[model samples]
Every structure is written in structure tokens, then in C-alpha cells.
Target: MEFIYSHNLTVDGREILLHIWDVPNSQEQAEDGSSEEKRIQWADSFVLVYSICDRASFNILPLKIQFIKAAKEGQSQEKVPIVIVGNKRDLHHQRVVSSEEGRLLALSLDCGFYEVSAAEAYHGALMVFHGLAKLIPDTKLALKKGTGIRGIVKTMSAVFARKRTDSL
Candidate 1:
């Protein structure tokens, strides 16, 4: 699998990091067991993305739920929000996963679910992150003091700059 694209977007002065994964097959394996764990650790919220065209991928929903449950169990009292995303809505004719199923699953898991088509530049993914950010208790305090969004961006930029400077 490869990362097709990534973008950093700011909404209401808050930063959001977006990444798109390009997997050749429905099955994804992490060469290093730590990579998946590391990603879960870094993410305070997760969006389980799936293509509506892939029927096989839909079968993995149980596994995805298990992973999320495990992650939540291992985390502190604060549970991370998990959003289920069904992409490729434009290909309705080829859709294998119906919106009802998605909704039912989300309802059962007590999470949010959305069906979108990125081909039209749908903002569903961004909305998911925005919602998660709002749900975080520290978001308002950080935004109010101007230490949350700006601080994170500044720190990230400085870290990358230092890495580049060191490599020179």
C-alpha cells in the first residue's frame, strides 16, 4: 500500500491532517507490528474509510470494530471517536454497501457514519475530523488561549525545519 495523497487543512482556525491510503488489495498488512499500534496511539480519533465498490472490504467491518474496541480498552478513560466512512457514493450503481447498513453499524457502535464521494470533493472526511476536534474538551481552551491550533502548527513546522536543517 502507498499513501496516495495528504493535505493539511485549517477549519475555524483549527488544523486537521488528512491522509489517503492507496491499497492494492483489500488485505493490508503492516510489515512492522508496531506501525499499526503507533498510528492508533497518535490518533485521538479515527475514521475507518471504505470504498462502496469493494464488497470484500465491507466484510472487514467486524475486524475494524474489534480493533477500535481494543484500542479504546487500552487507552485512558477518554475514548477516541471512530467514524465510519463509505466513499464512492458517485458509483451508486456499483455500490456494495448500502447507507442503511452503514447507519445501522454506526448506530450499534454509537458512532458517526457518512456516505460520500470524494470525486465531487465532498467534505465528509474533513467534517469527521472537525467533529472530533469539537468533541475534545481541550479544544475550546486551546483555541481561546490561541495556544492550541497555532501552537501545534508552529511546533510541527519547527520540528520539520530542524530535521531538514540537521540533514544538511
Candidate 2:
């Protein structure tokens, strides 16, 4: 199943409109027959979510990252802002993927990491998207100022690394 969620948020005194396209990783075809490649191409940023209790789902994250990166090849001016979220965090007893593992993965990917339970509390889920929203403006500013990839990465790392809280 796919869902398009639209929300407007103000970050740093600027109102930003976000249209989040949520798609499953299943092989099923869309009604319009849109391929995975097309979806990756259309995305400006990515929020890759996996269930904390599902190791197989966590294992596939690297492949998905590769797909996103490959789809973005040669687009030097475009910054890839990605966030890795471990859902079902309330199920601590059933957890297969450690929060540490998720944090390390996000550090390696140079993106934000969040562990949230959509079923337990809404705040956690909101934080994940809000964090991503905050990244976009910084990314665009970096590009506009000609700070390049290194600058963008540095800025993003600082934001995600410092503010990361292991709420699990």
C-alpha cells in the first residue's frame, strides 16, 4: 500500500510544505505501473523505516540505500537527505535490531536516526518527520551558498549527531 501525506511546518521562521510519499518495498506494481526506479527518481529525500522486531526488514536497508544512491548518481548539486527510522520501538521485548545498531547505521549513512512506535505515542513519529523537515532547508542553503557536499554532510552530521536521543 502507498500513502501520500502532506503537512506544512515552520522551521527557522519559514513555512515549508512537505509531501511524504510512503511506499512499501513489496514487488507489487502500482496502479499506474510506476517502477521503483521512478519512485526513487522522484524523491528529494528518503525516510527508510524498518520494524525493530524484524531483522529481515532491517537487513534490507543497505540495499535500499544503495538504490537511492545509485538513482542519484551524477547529481552532484542535489543533496540526499535521508532518515533511518526503527519502528515498533514499544515492543522492546520482541526487538531483533538493537538501537545501537540503528544509530551506527545512521552515522555511517550520515543521516538522522529515530526509534519510534507509531502505536504507542504520536510524539516520536512526529519527531522523525520534523527532524527530516529541518534538514531540507540546511541542505538547500548549503547548495545555494556553494558549500558543496562536504559542507552539507558536515552540517547534517552535526544536527543529527548532537540531537539524537535514544528514546528506546
Candidate 3:
């Protein structure tokens, strides 16, 4: 089964909805009509993950990264940010992917790198989400700063525009 976790985050007075979906391993089938390859290209940002204890899992990441770049061809690569995370640090004794290897990969991609264990490192887990949040621009603040009732109307317009496009 496909696993999805949804959470609403209030950061800097703005409410951001984050949809965290785990990409299922099977490439042959999907519950929905669309393929995972098709859905991935539509994402605004990516949090590509791998288990530090599983070297094979870590090895596949390069192919995934390459696919993301190729899928986003012609668009400014910077616009589509990525955050590489090495999880299962709780089992560091069994870790197969070195911290240096993860850092080097992140540097190569020009994206942020974070090592956190969801089971143990509480602060580090939050930092990963916070780090990803920093990548997204706060567009609402710009709209909310305008003077008078006109500002409210402009903000409403923006909200509706976003909703309309989202429904499609």
C-alpha cells in the first residue's frame, strides 16, 4: 500500500500544508491511473530519502535524482529544489552510508543535506522540515503588506486563483 502523511504547519504566521508521500517500490503498478514517474515531475520540491543502514537503497538515489533533473528539463533547475535526507541514524552502528558520502552527494546536487533519525533524533527531524520550509518563498506576506481594504481584496483574489488552479 502507498503511505501518505499530511500535516499542517504554522510557520512565521503562515499556514503551510505539507503532503508527505512515500514512493512505493514497485514500478509496475499503481493504485491510481497515473504512474509514479508522472506524479514526481509535478512536485514543487523533493525530499529524497534513503536508509543509512541500507547501502543498496542509497545506491538507487543517484538514478532517482537524475530522473528528477531530466523530467524537469528546460525549467530552471534551481526552482525545483531537493533535500537529501539520510534516515535511520538511530541505528548508526549498522549504518552503511557514510555521512561524508551523503554530504558529497548533496554538494553535487547543490541542495541541502540532513541526517536525522525519526525514532531518536527529535530536534534533527524538526530541523529537516524547517530546512525544507526555508526553500519555499512566503508569497502571502508580500500580498498581505499592501495598504487598506484593497490589500484584503488582492489577497482574496490570490487565494481564489490558487484554489481554481488547484481544482483542475
Candidate 4:
């Protein structure tokens, strides 16, 4: 198993980590195991992204749900937000999971749900993280203190700009 792509984004003062794994169709280990459990333990939140174009990916839904349940079970500190992301929203005609079904499943699992298009470098993923970050108590306090959203964005922008300038 290898991660095909990954991105790190900061939202409302919390680090949002996104990872996309590429696993062979023959791999049974990808479905469930101890390693998956370890990954869930490490993450503050989990967002499972499934491709609407592929029905095989839909089979992973049961595994995703199990991971969320395991996360909730193992959580001793606080509730970690779990989100089911249905990618390929641009292909509405090919949608496998309807918004209504997504909402219902999310409600049942007490998590969040969204349908987005990662093909366009989905900004919705960042927005979802931002929304979840807002729910963090420390993040909320920081925002209230005026040392929050604006400050973080400015600092991040400046840091990235400096990096780009140095590279140039």
C-alpha cells in the first residue's frame, strides 16, 4: 500500500491531514487490520474519501464505518470528528451515493458527510476541515481572543510566500 497523494492544511488553528492511498485490488489487507487501527489512533479526525466512479471503492464503506466506530471506541480524550467524503461530485450523473443517503449515514454514525470533486483539487475538503476545526474549544477561544483565523491565515501565507521567494 502506498499513498498516491497527501496534503497538509491548517484550518482554524488545527492541522488537517489528508492522505490518499493506492492499494492493489488483490490486497485483502487493505480491507481491515491492525495497521489501519494504528492510523485511526494517530489521527485527531478521519475523513474517508470514496470515488463515485468506482463501485469497488464503495465496498470499502463497511471498512470506513468500522474504522470510525473503532476510533470512537478508542477515544478517551474527546470525540474525534469523522467525515465520509464522496469524491467526483462533478460527475453528478455518476453519483453512487446520494446526498440524502450520505446525510442519513452520517446522522446514524454521528459524523459529517460531503460530496466533492478532488479532480479540481477540491477546496471543499479544506472547508470541511475548517468547519470541524471551529468546533475545537481551544480554537474557538483563540478566535474569540482575536488571535485566531485571520492571524493564522496571515502567518501561514507569509511563511509560504517566504519559502517560495527563497526557492526562487
* Best prediction by lDDT: 2
**At residue 116, what lDDT does model 2 achieve?**
96
Candidate lDDT values, in order: 0.63, 0.73, 0.68, 0.59
Sorted by lDDT, highest first, which candidate order results? 2, 3, 1, 4
Q: Please give, for residues 37-141, the per-residue lDDT of candidate 2 as tens digits.
A: 666655567899999999988888887787677677556555578899999988999999999999999998777899999998889978987788777746553
Query: Which stretches in model 1 have alpha-carbon errors above 4 Å?
Result: 1-27, 30-32, 139-168
- The positional error of residue 20 in candidate 1, measured at the CA in angstroms, is 8.2
The 10-residue segment with the lowest total lDDT in model 3: 159-168
**Model 1 weakest 10-residue run by lDDT:** 159-168
What's model 1's lDDT at 66? 74
**C-alpha-based local distance difference test score of model 2:** 0.73
Which candidate model has the greater TM-score, 3 or 4? 3
* Global local distance difference test of model 4: 0.59
lDDT of 3 by residue, 37-141 (tens): 455644556787889998877787777778777676456545556889999988989999999999999898777899989888578867877788778666622
Clashing pairs in 1: none
Task: Record all residue pairs in model 3 with backbone atoms less than 3 Å apart, i.e. clashing.
Answer: none
**Model 4 worst lDDT window (10 residues):** 159-168
Judge candidate 2 at residue 148 and give its lDDT: 39
- lDDT measured at residue 163 in model 2 versus the true structure, 0 to 100: 50
